[model samples]
Target: MCTEELATWRDVSLVLLAAEALLTGLPVALILGASLRRLSRLMVGMRTVLFQARMYVWRTGEVTRRAMGMVAAPFIQLQSTVHGLCRALDILGWR
Candidate 1:
């Protein structure tokens, strides 16, 4: 009879421990869920910002390319004209 009482007390203690663990874990789980939700929202905002930044970089690069081409145009035209004059002089035996 003493052994049966001891066994019943052990079972009761085990049930109490499990209940305590569940109570402790519930709030932790809820906090983690909320943190994940906030993180998801932050990631979405970051994605939009990054996309805008990428577009701006692409546009800047395109503008730079066009500017460089415009800056080089006169030099290219002068060189081509010089080359054509030399070719014409060579054809006429002007050396």
Candidate 2:
């Protein structure tokens, strides 16, 4: 093989070996890390959705009172529950 191809193969082999080591010693870390990455991505998506929904409710300039605000609260609360995983979920899951 060419010199550059040989170098790339060696680098890839090193990475594979490191991954094998990690899997052998810290399989849970890999699983939890993947889970955390997914959670972070979900939070990012939820953040964008909540931002747009809040902007829609506020900038409409038509729903600026108790009834409108109350109607908006449930949606906001739903988003909050999702974002925060709710008080109960947090308590149960963390413990």
Candidate with top lDDT is: 1
Off by over 4 Å in 2: 1-25, 57-95
Return the top candidate by TM-score.
1
lDDT of 2 by residue, 4-75 (tens): 999999999999999999878797887889999999999998998999999998877655676778888899
lDDT of model number 2: 0.86
RMSD (CA, Å), candidate 2 to true, equals 21.3
Looking at model 1, residue 44 earns an lDDT score of 91
Colliding pairs, model 1: none
Residue 79's lDDT in candidate 2: 93
TM of each candidate vs. truth: 0.53, 0.31
Q: For each candidate, how many residue pairs have backbone atoms clashing (under 3 Å)? A: 0, 0
- Model 1: ten consecutive residues of lowest lDDT: 65-74
